[model samples]
Each structure stands twice: as structure tokens, then as C-alpha cells.
Target: MPDTYNITLEISRYDPESHLSWVQTYQVEAGGILRFVDVFRKINDEQDPTLAWASSCEHAQCGSCGIMVNGKPLLACELLVREAVDQFNTHTFRIKPITIAPVLRDLVVDLEKAYDRVHAAKPYLMKPAPAPPEGDEYRISPETLETYVEATQCINCFCCATACISSHHHFLGPNAMMSNIVRLMDPRETEKKERMDLLYGESGVYRCHTARACSFVCPKEIDISHFLALGKEGKF
Candidate 1:
């Protein structure tokens, strides 16, 4: 038979209108296999309808449901109950919104705020000058594409931003930095010096102290610090 576990949750709550932030506790009974999302679902369904959080694709692929579980940034959908217990080393889980983000309600944060720097960096491909001289000239070697492929997997979850120590400053954080690197690695991008200037600018890659907290909390297991280090060396 599947096992059932009793868990205690201490969640942070904020009221936008009243400017109130507080912590509340709840006792829940859940299956041992259930994820943190499931626990939150139970809380919303039965315990408190007013509680709020964000969740989609409940498998870590969407990168939503990012929150601080016992002071660690993580995807609520991906972290199992047993794993959370072991990771936190406590029976009661203390949950809150990730750092460096404005809390929209309770667990849900202002995703737009997290995306601001990325928007400023121009994350998408710039249209080639002169329209690329027809389509055939735009292709890249398979080996070249392979180099930056991993960087493209960033889901824009903002977990890295939460884990970053320098986020208190104007630093752009991990996802935005990776976006800059991806464009740098792309063979067709022509403004190499311009992109590098942005990457190395104030609140840029130089601000990262290589704490690797961003890499450690990333649900995707991306080597974000490695990319920044390579960027510093101008290795591309």
C-alpha cells in the first residue's frame, strides 16, 4: 500500500491592499509520493480558498511554481514530499516567494519584474541586416549550434534570480546573462562588440561572484556560472 505522511507547512502571505506580510501554518495529510504542488492544492481546496500560488505543467518543464521551500528556491511541482523533508531537515516546511521578486499575492510573484532585464537585453534574434542576402546564406554549422544549445534551455523561471546574491544590486542575474551568451554564440549575430559591451557592463557578468547558487537552484541543472566564466574570458 502507498504510504501517507502528515506534514506541516509554514507559508508566507502578503496582502497587496493592506501592505501586510505574515506567516501562517497548516497541517496536512498527503501521500508520500505527492509533490509540493499537491500539498498546496490540498490547502487551497480544503483549508484556505484565499491562499494563492502559481503552477502549470506540474512537472518542472514549465518552470512555474517556483518558490522558496525552507529558504531554498525550487519548483513546487518537481520537489517530492520526501525529498523536501530530507533537503530541509525538518518536519515543517517554511515556504515563501523567491527573493528579488515582488510578491503579487502569496506564493505568486510578479513574473514581469523577473523578465525586465531580459527584455532590456533583447532576447530574440535580431533581423539580419540587408535581409540576409536571401535565406540560403543564413545557415550555421551543426557544431556551432551545438555549443550554445544548452543555454537555450533556460525556461525564464526566475529561480536563478532568486538564488543570486548580487540581485540586490542592479545585476541582470542568470537567465538574462545566459540569453546574452546565446546570442553571442549564434553565428549569424553581427553586433559582437555591442553584445559584449552589454554583457560586461555595470550590473553585468562582472557582478557575479561565482557563488553558484543560481546553478544549484536551477531546476534545469544548467551550468550558468560556467557560461559567465567563459564569457569573462572572451572564449565565446
Candidate 2:
């Protein structure tokens, strides 16, 4: 039989209409490998059907299930029961929504609003360089792709934004800055001047205090601050 743990989850609950909030606790018996998403599912299945949380593509690729586990932003689908218990050295875990956006419900935040800054960065390659003479494949060398490949791995999880101390103070946060940085480093993108303007704008890289919290809690393990630092130096 797999080892089982009796875990206690103190989840933060919020009702937007009443603007009321509270903590609700649930007890669950989970196997060592069971994820926190599975634990939430079990709670909804057997204990509380009214529980509200967002999740899709439970493999940690979608970043839909980003939440705070014991005060740290993390992907719920990636945290295992045994790992949580061992890391915190406790059977009880405190669960809360990521602070990057306004909470809409129990563990659910308004992700669309959170995506505004990222959208402002214009994540696509605007002004592509003439499409490589029309007939030939627009090929990019591996060496060129390597320049900003890691930044492309960002799933827009907002975990980095939540952990960023700079985000709360009119800053565009780490991932949003990385979005612009990736485009800035891409050889195909020709709109460098516009991106530079945005990066140096009021809510841009200048607001970053280099707290490194964004790098610390990123689910993708992206060194987001490093790229932002590069942006600070105009290194692209």
C-alpha cells in the first residue's frame, strides 16, 4: 500500500458580491504522489461541491492552477502531498490565491485582468524582417534561437507577478517585462524602438527593485529577473 498522509488544507474563500472572505479547512487522506490539485478535487468530490478554483491541463503547462501554497506562489498540479509535507515539515498547509490579480472567488482570480500588462507588451513579433525573400523558409539559426529561448517558455502563469514586490507599485512585473525582452532579443522582430519606449516607461523596468522574488517563485524555474536586468542595461 502506498504511504498516505492525513493533510489539512486551510483554503482562503472569497465572495465577490458580498466582498466577504474567510478561511475554510478540509481534511484529506492522500497518497504521497497525489498532487494538490488532486487534493482540491477530492475536497470538491466528497466534501464540498461549492468550492471554486480554476484548473485545466493539470500537467503544469497551462498555468491555470497557479495558487499560493504555504505563502509561496506555485502550480497546484505540480505540488505533491509528500513533498509539501516534507518541505514545510507540517501536515497542515495554507492555501490562497495568487496576489497578482483581484480574487474572483475561492482560489480563483481574474486572470484576464492580470494579463493586461502582458498584452501591453505586444508579445508577438511586430514588424517581422521582410519574411526572408518570400520563397525561402524564414530560417533562424540555433545560435540565434538560443538568445531568448528560455523566455519563450513562460506560460503567463502570473506566479512571478504575484511574488514580485515591484508589481504592486505600478510596475509591469517580471513576466510582462520578459515578454518584451524576448521580442527585443529576437532577430526577426524589428520594432525595437517601441519596445524600448515601453520598457523605459513609467510602469516598466525602471520600477523593478531587483527583489528577485519573481525569480524565486516562478513555476517554470525561469530566471526572469536576469532578463529584466539585461533590459535595464539595454542589452536586449
RMSD of 1: 2.1
Q: What digit string (tens of lDDT, one per residue) describes model 2 on residues 178-222?
A: 999899999888999999999999989999989999889888888
| Model 1 local distance difference test score | 0.84
Top candidate on lDDT is 2
Instruction: Output the lDDT of residue 182, model 2.
Output: 93
Report the alpha-carbon TM-score of model 1 versus the true structure. 0.92
Candidate 1: tens digits of C-alpha lDDT, residues 1-236: 33777889999999998989999999998887889998999999999989999998987788779999887888999888888777777679999998767889989888887778788677876644343556656777789887888888888888888889887668898889879878988876777787888888996888888999988988988888888887888887
Number of the top candidate by TM-score? 2
- Which runs of model 2 end up more than 4 angstroms from their true locations? none
Error of 1 at 47 (Å): 0.6
Model 2 alpha-carbon miss at residue 109, Å: 0.6
Q: What are the Cα lDDT values of the candidates?
A: 0.84, 0.91
Q: What are the C-alpha RMSDs, in order, of all predicted structures?
A: 2.1, 1.5
